[model samples]
Target: MNSASVISVVGPTGTGKSALALSLAEILDGEIVNADSMQFYRGMDIGTAKVSVAERRGIAHHLLDILDVTEEASVSDFQRQARQAIAEIQGRGKRAILVGGSGLYVRAVLDVLEFPGTDPRIRQRLEVEAEAHGMAELRARLQRVDPASAERVADDRRVIRALEVHEVTGKPFSSFMPVREYIQPTVQIGLDIPRPVLHERLSTRVNQMVDQGLADEVERLDQRGLRTGKTAGRALGYAQFLRVLDGEATVAAAAEETIIATRQFARRQSTWFRADPRIRWLDPREDDVVDQAAALCL
Candidate 1:
């Protein structure tokens, strides 16, 4: 493989993406660029399943733990940083491996996606409309105008962004769907796990997180202003645990809800990535996953 080739390992959260990426980096003399949005926060290690220093096996990793819990993650910002990291790694004659299950973040790094400049007036107007009509109504309007964008972006913030883009550019947000092309020389590998097994694994993973003091982690972050952060406050496990802190639910109940939400998220990720034909799918249970992916890279 050329030194400039970028390899991305993507799948659901519990699919062992980090392990595969570690192996690939060791074999390919690569450095990792993280694409998981949640892992951007510095102290969100346990909930996001960030690989520990020991697990990284001394491979240089970039873009992990760069954001505070109170900061909103911007895909556009991440795109810039990730591209720079890739260039730097490849410039050093090493491989650049992008690893995560965040579908849009992955595309932001690899695809020819342009982040449009926002108009404050348009954004303000959309915020007012969302406040007056509600997020569901605003999302419904976006569904009519840009169904493709509406399908993937369900958050109020992202829906507002889509509408703002449409108003500013006079183009449907869906018109920006990434072409089946890469901005850089790249190969993508996806893990294929059965739904039943994935769901069970997700549940077990959530249980493990709880055992690893997820509640305490959330408590620490909450005290550190996580509640004020628009994006981080709504993260899957942290949000559920916040309810636990409020006495609205038990930690057990929170874990169950997190499991369900993670399963749904995995389904969405699967759908998003399956639509891309360039990704080479492999069964994670297979012993030769690293070899299979390395063959594609080389």
Candidate 2:
């Protein structure tokens, strides 16, 4: 890896990426840049498992807690902000360590990705159509217009965006997909964990979040227009806990649901990162994992 190139720590959730990133930063004289989309929002700490200030060990971190709960996160915006942060860090003669499980957000920063322009009129029309007709209806439209994106994208938001892009740009949204080519000389370190162990860790983590007042955190954010926020409202634990606040589920039931959802999300994340051939995979269980990762950076 080039001495000035950014280092990324990526993998599924609960795989100890943050701890490794912190260690790498300490060893390499690096600053941390968050790539997790959910971690962008303020007052979302507990459920997102955002590292606390003290846990940072005086290391400088960027792109975290910069948005309110009501705002939607944009990958295009994150790309700009993260690149600027990386450039500044490099200019200061320090390494830049990017860390998160959000696959697309990470790619947006490190890979040659370009976002298509958006028109409010087209977006609003699509949103209204989705609300009136349903996501299945829009997804069917997406399937007809951009079958590749339709097959790959599973979220309602991306489904609508795909359709909007096809309409506005006269091209398939998949055409804008990033190639694996990196924009800079970079090294990605992925943490590999056993499936059964990851499942248990996710379950235990969700239960611990509940114990650590995930419910209270959700309740507080709900007052701050969390439900009105399109992106934040759908976050794994927050969504289930919101059901609890609505009397639709109990805390125990919400925690169980969150565990299942998080496991599924982790599986998707693992699949995404696994597809990238450039990342160096390491077993986090090994005692020399940090040393192995540092050696790769050098």
- Say which candidate scores most in lDDT: 2
lDDT at 80 for candidate 2?
98
The TM-score obtained by model 2 is 0.98
Model number with the top TM-score: 2
What's the C-alpha lDDT at position 21 in model 1? 93
For candidate 2, the 10 contiguous residues with the lowest summed lDDT are 1-10
* lDDT of predicted model 2: 0.95
Clashing residue pair totals per candidate (backbone < 3 A) = 0, 0
State the lDDT of candidate 1 residue by residue for 221-263, as single tens digits.
9999998898889888999999999999999899999999999
Report lDDT (CA) for all predictions. Answer: 0.91, 0.95
| Deviation (Å) of 213 in candidate 2 | 0.8
**Alpha carbon deviation, residue 166, candidate 2 (Å):** 1.2
